[model samples]
Target chain A: MSRLSIRSFSSSPIASKVGYSTVQPVHHLIPIKKQTLGKRFPELNIPKDDIRSPQYKPKDVYQDRVNEYYQNVLKSDLLLHYYEHDSEAVTGNKARSWGEFSPYAVYRRDRKPKGLSRATRDIKPVTPRNIPELTGISINLYNKAALEESWINISARLQLAQITNVKPKVVYNKSNVLPWKVRQGKECGCKVELEGRDMTRFLSTLVELVLPRIRTFKGIKDSSGDKSGNITFGLSPEEIKFFPEIENFQELFPNLFGFHLTFKTNAGTDERARTLLTSLGLPFYKEVKNVQ
Target chain B: MWKSGLRKYSAAASSTASAGNSTSISSTLLLTRNPVITADVSKFEAQYYKYQNELWKRLMWTFPSWFYYRKGTISEQAFRELNPGPVFNNPNIEFPRGRPVVVHQRDRRFKQELKLPKTYKEVSQEKKEGGETAAEEEGAKEDNLSRQIVPNSRITKADESKDLASLERQLSRTLYLIIQENSKWTLPTFKEEQVAQGDDTKDSSVTPLHTLAEQGLYKIGGNSINYFNVSNTPCHVHKSESTREYFIKSHILSGRFVPQSESIKFLWLTKEELGEYLEKDYYKEIEHLLSDI
Candidate 1:
């Protein structure tokens, strides 16, 4: 193992602004000359730039690396599809076409040349402007009445970033809750809304690896879905540990907290949303019957 | 620094007190916050039923069929000329106003294809150079040949005496195609699979039932085919022919069966249906192993 770098703590004595004395226990009472501790141990001296310069933090560095990975590796034909009209966003659209996995399902709709005497203004089967599909995933981390430590919020943000493979934004309280000691604009937790390929990939991992490994999980409850079709589920701290990314590196996260995961589907009804989720291999359980 | 230590101790005590107070407060706060977790059940019921009622109303609205119109009408004449009521144009025959069907349509205009993840074979081939050296080429060829246990040429020779030996052993595990000949249902009869004498039989280590099952006997055009065995193992093997012929029971996991030959008119019937439809002699012969027909 490498020896501890003295430069890291060379300036610590100066920071204390007080010297320890064995001969004179009451050094504060006795007059003494200021000591240059660095002169005695030159190896302990760190460069001025190293001590005072503002540098990118470890989380920032990791976030940059993740962004690079998302751009170079994850953003490909297997994930993102580029439109022909918007070429710059697409970047040579023909090169990275969806190929066999194109989302648009086409059908030949033969319409007789329409005129003033057309039977109906609308086309057959009603060609939709957009298809019903998974739009995004919203993950909310709720920290109950704990807003004092910025480090906890930062760690939670980093944890979410690590799990989602995307940077998370810290959420602040919109209104003050006097009893809970929550003040308006105080950072409480973090959230991440993933869309496009990232959304699908995160969902796939949750369905295939994460949920199956969780012992206490009994599938998404039937009553969990909102009236508008979005389904929400809660994971306990123990269940969060089952995520393969976190499970493999337990030491990195000392206090892993759970979050509420919401799947935002374009399917208008709960039944269609359930069907879509089922197709993605997420099992749904029937509501438990209540005793009379 | 000595004075700061005393200050830090006091700060820590205050922080712990606050933490304890917050925890207790939040617990009580949760009772009021319960509304945030639970959803409105009656609202969901209203929304779900509203969608269902709309779907039911849509289902009642039928498409205007050209056949229902008068023969002299323009719609009927156009329908006859165009013939646009789900022929080869719409092979799936999905109802126009029904549930949305998702299809994967390949865009031929896209010429530049992105690289897919390489397989082990491809990685090895790249390491050896693009020419595909003799050893690797032979290995690939062997793999391809092995995957096809029964060659197309041997499909006709499936009923030979040499092949029948293994079929009789695995009779309870194979699926036999029952055909309707002159309105009388009976199991499909196989002819001999032709092979040249001393024709590389050394390479083939497959049983007759596996070989027969893989063949395109009841051909499914273009669609991929797969087979899986039924799990109801019979106590006794059923054989109709005195020559000791036997067949295994299996199901088509995927693919639709279209007849390769005009003479092959088949139906997938249950054991009881087969018992009712087939001749008494045929049904009686296979009665013991008719749990899954």
Candidate 2:
């Protein structure tokens, strides 16, 4: 109560008049809460990750076999597989600097990377500490039907949540297009980012159960990467039904949504990422377009 | 870098000089059975995990029974009967201790313990009630989906009986296949057939190291064994005065390794056990190649 009284007295206009100053006192744009004002309420200021914090949540609940397999078995194998006699880091096209004597060059950014708008990452040789591994998976669903009837997106969100254990965030349209009927601020679909145990569980389910069950499903395309370590592939609505969650609860979901899955890795290069994904049980196939 | 270059040059020169003697190239099989179960955690680790799991359960959101079981349905009633509501925070009650903070049929202070209604009849319950005969119970149609999910024991019969040769022995550690040939325990190595000097036939061509290892594996341990070779390229090389043994890593996916010959003896052993059984110097040299887990 004493602390609260002192806080209230400090904020009053008369408190400013007691102290002489050259500048006028400015009020905070946002009103400060009493709980966050004083050092006495240290519990409120504690980080959420700390055990004493009210919002603290436990993370490592069980052993992850996929991560263990990578650590114990795959790490050394990858190092050996990628080993070359006296290999060096293959550097990418870096940005060039403007002349230092130029007056316009002062406080200016360097020119864009050669032949590309964005700079690419260097492809480093695989070592014991830098073995490529799957970091996370991002699943994005774009529902065209939701552009007209927004209620249809709820089912898509629920479907994604059912398949992946994590709750998905709703994606919204960015620009307005009159012909396509796309408008800004409209809820389109959903996306879910999976990491750690969730990522391994989703990967195993996709490889062992889902991918093999699809009749027309070939492997992911050989040319399906962003040149960096991220690889993306899409599943059809018909093939999405192969998921066990949707197969069992078919009646609950009427319209299945086809979504794109992007596998993110820290392998530095797409080729290494592909090899890592193959070792983790995902296959890649080359597409033969023409045979004359 | 210069040192490595020098070593490589020296090795190349030595190999050329020994060309007259013809160094024998052998493929060593490093076939292993991956751990079937998660690795065993230490006592402290187990305790920490348990504590974290308990905290997770305590802080978890209340289970939405209203969504799964309708408000006025038979299944809802059964669920309610199985899981009784926590003590309500009544304004009329005179309390000596702290007041109960109840929300969504749960006490916020304690972890919610829910007992779900069982879908299938348990075998123990049937035996206790003495309603069905043992033969009748066995003959009943078993629906896989409706059946109770009881995990198999991690410790198999082979482990309990201390069967070293059984593939089912270790559930949580990698098991390597080591064979005893001529009273010496070593990794199964297959040597290349010496080619005739004047024979220039396609049949007498040099076989790849991985192929040699595969054929040798099948020749000794029957074709029923299902395995996956990690890569065609050799992972490690051990060079001696006469022979160069290249290690080919592989994993036994399924099936068993059955020794075809009477004299050949094999045992599935972990890394530490391999050290005890194998030659001291050989084990020390290949220690980094073996997985501790």
Best by lDDT: 2
Off by over 4 Å in 2: A1-43, A94-119, A237-255, B1-25, B95-97, B119-137, B141-145, B194-208, B239-243
Model 2 RMSD to the real structure? 9.4
Tell me which residue pairs clash in candidate 2. none
RMSD of each: 37.0, 9.4
How accurate locally is residue A16 in candidate 1, as Cα lDDT from 0 to 100? 28
Candidate 1, residue A211: lDDT: 90
Using DockQ as the measure, which candidate wins?
A: 2
Q: lDDT tens string, model 1, B1-293? A: 00111111111222234443321100000000001111223576556656644432322212213213344778556644543322223447674655332111111111112233465556656757876676865677686853323223322243344342121212212233466546665555432243333431333522243233344243322235344442111112334322223343444545545556566566544456566667888578766544331
- Evaluated on chain A only, model 1 obtains a TM-score of 0.56
Task: Score residue B86 of candidate 1 by CA lDDT.
Answer: 25
lDDT of 2 by residue, A1-292 (tens): 3322211112223322221111212212123465555787776567867876644667777677788888887887788667656767777788879978999999899999978898777777777778888999999999999999998888888789879977788899999998988999999999999998888889989999999998877899999999888999999899999899899758657899999999999887788899999989999999998889
